[model samples]
Target: MRPIVVTTMLSLDGVMDSPGGGEHPRAGWTFKEVPFEEAAYEIKGREQEEAGSMLLGRVSHDEFAPVWPTMPEFEQYNAMPKYVVSSTLEGSEWNNTHVLRSLDDVAALKDSDEPGSIIVHGSATLAQGLATAGLVDRYHLLVFPLLLGTGKRLFSTDTPTGGITGLSVLESETYANGVQKLVLDVVR
Candidate 1:
């Protein structure tokens, strides 16, 4: 079985929206607070190397598909198998992309004989749903120092009370730019 890892860039207040420039009011906040660090890229590259596939929600897929394909840095990512969990999307124009209609499809993907990790990036809704359903095996969070008080957060009050999940910190590292990287395993 392959591990489903959810990776995200979050703010101190838990906001994960628009870590890069986008439509959010607090968009580009991460760039403002976190300086460019070669270590960050090295860490991300390592993760990418371990991943066999990439899973994304509709919004995230839409946001990434157009730009990532054109970038040299994302050449490997663009080449990997991409799965988008979206009931509405009938087909995908992106190369090596597949559409999964439901959570059951996601579960099946995890159970499949895939060779390496199935990594998710910037899929806030998908990540939360996976976490709530206890489908997420690990969480790779790069927590930025700044707080955007009013934006979409990683964890919200809407999470089910009885379904609280525990996480074991597998690794933690603080960068020179005050960005903290936490690798957590879901304590299921």
Candidate 2:
């Protein structure tokens, strides 16, 4: 089965809102800081290598489809297979991408004969849904030191809960700029 992995940017308070403290949410919270350039590069590279395909929600797909295609650093990702989970999106303008209309399809994808994992990034709602549905196999939360205290939250709803556990601590490291990346394996 292609492992289902989630990679997200979160705040110290466990809030997955805008890391960018300004008007742009989750903007400045990334490794865009001058000191975090090398660290960010390494992390992104690792993530790319670890995943065989990307599963994006509507929001993240909209945001990523426009920008990632233009950035050379993320060119590999743009070329990578992307499965967008969206009910409204009838078609995709991006290359190497397909839209999935139902959450039920997740299980079949997980069982795909893919070489690598199916990774989810910046899809808080979808991530939460996958976790609640007991579909996720692993989670990578990159915690930054700062907090906006409000914005996009990781857990969007409270109704579907109590599906995740058996988290084996995989790796944790503190960066120079206080961003700590924690990788966890969700034991099934």
Number of the top-ranking candidate, with TM-score as the measure = 1
Candidate 1 colliding pairs, count: 0
Query: Candidate 1, overall lDDT?
Result: 0.86
Look at candidate 1 and give me any clashing residue pairs. none
Across 121-163, the per-residue lDDT of candidate 2 in tens digits comes to 8877888888888888888887777765677677655646436
| Model 2 per-residue lDDT at 72 | 86
Candidate 2: regions farther than 4 A off: 19-26, 31-37
lDDT by candidate, in order shown: 0.86, 0.78
Candidate 1 lDDT over 1-188, as tens digits, reads 89999888898889999989788887888786679776755668877899999999999999998899898988788999999999899878888999999988999999999878999998778888887777888888988899788777677668852254588999898889988899998875
Superposition TM-score, candidate 2 onto the true structure: 0.88
RMSD of each: 1.4, 2.5
The superposed Cα distance between candidate 2 and the true structure at residue 132, in angstroms, equals 0.6
